[model samples]
Target: MSELIIGVLGLQGAVSEHIKQIEATHCKGIIVKKPEQLHDIDGLILPGGESTTMRKLIDRYGFLEPLKQFSLQQKPIFGTCAGMVLVAKDLTDSDDVHLKLMDVRVKRNAFGRQKESFEATLQIKGFESPYTAVFIRAPYIETAGDQVAVLATYENKIVAAKQDHILVSAFHPELTSDTRFMKLFVDMVKKSKEIAAY
Candidate 1:
């Protein structure tokens, strides 16, 4: 099979880090700066960053509708940290939602400010061992729809989840050296491409 191409929303956040991880999985990673670039990738990674600022850039770059359409196509999306907030259908603190693609209610900065950032070992679902997770001004899922499968939690708060092609995590997987989290997303993309071929 040909190598999969994954894109990192380059408007903001850990774009290079995600690119590195995507390449680590033996896939091509591109920084998607325009709406039309979405058509070239089999999957996308919304990296960690300031959700509000990223939203502004998304609108400025005219990516809002294209991003929504990308999700509608059932191409896999992995949202990390602020990216998770962007994809959520609802926010505990605000009525405004960006993508509204994921069926979850998220609370921004649920873990406190940047100085409060810390790391924790998480027992993610489907993984055989604990994964070290880094949380920096993160958001946690307060509620998820029936279709959402809760993947992992920290302090009893939902930190990771998957609903069909949308995968999200409150922590930044790119911050850690472990590629397991990224591998999971890669697998999701592989499965999606396989299904689309038929």
Candidate 2:
């Protein structure tokens, strides 16, 4: 297989952390600040950051439409923390909705403020062992559509979900040393590229 190139939206967030994780997976990770950069990526990662700021930057940088087009093409998109909130169809915490590409409804900061942040081991579906998840003022999915597959939950709150090529998590996986989530996304990129090639 060819080396996969994944783009991390660099508007605002844990951009470099995600790039580090992607590189740890032996894939090329590039920071995308312009719409033209999106053309070269096999997949995209919207990292954890302030959703409102990210949303504003995305709009100011003319990324909203391109991102929607990318999602429409069914390429893999992994949204972490606030990124998850950005992609959701509904948000219980605020009226501002950005991407609306995912089939889930998220509640922003459902876990509380920064001081309330903590880490836990999550039993993600399809994984035999539990994965350590880091939640930093995170948001959990309040609801998922029938086509959405729940991946992990903490204290009965939905933390991870996947719908077709879109994946979301309320926690910051890049903050950990675990490469499982990054690998999963790389695999999704590979599979998406394969399907597009055919």
Best model number under lDDT: 1
Q: In lDDT terms, how accurate is model 1?
A: 0.95
Each candidate's lDDT (Cα)?
A: 0.95, 0.92
- Misplaced by over 4 Å in model 1 are none
The per-residue C-alpha lDDT of model 2 at residue 10 equals 96
When summed lDDT is taken over every stretch of 10 residues in candidate 1, the lowest stretch is 109-118
Deviation in angstroms for 50 in model 2?
0.2
lDDT of 2 by residue, 66-184 (tens): 99999998999999998999899998867788899988889988976753589989999988798999999999999899999999999899999999999999999899999998888
> Per-residue CA lDDT of candidate 1, range 1-198, in tens?
678999999999999999998999899999999999999999999989999999999999999999999999999999999999999999999988999998999999998765359899999999999999998988999999999999999989999999999999999899889999999999999999999999
| Reference-based TM-score, model 1 | 0.98
**Number of the predicted model whose TM-score against the real structure is largest:** 1
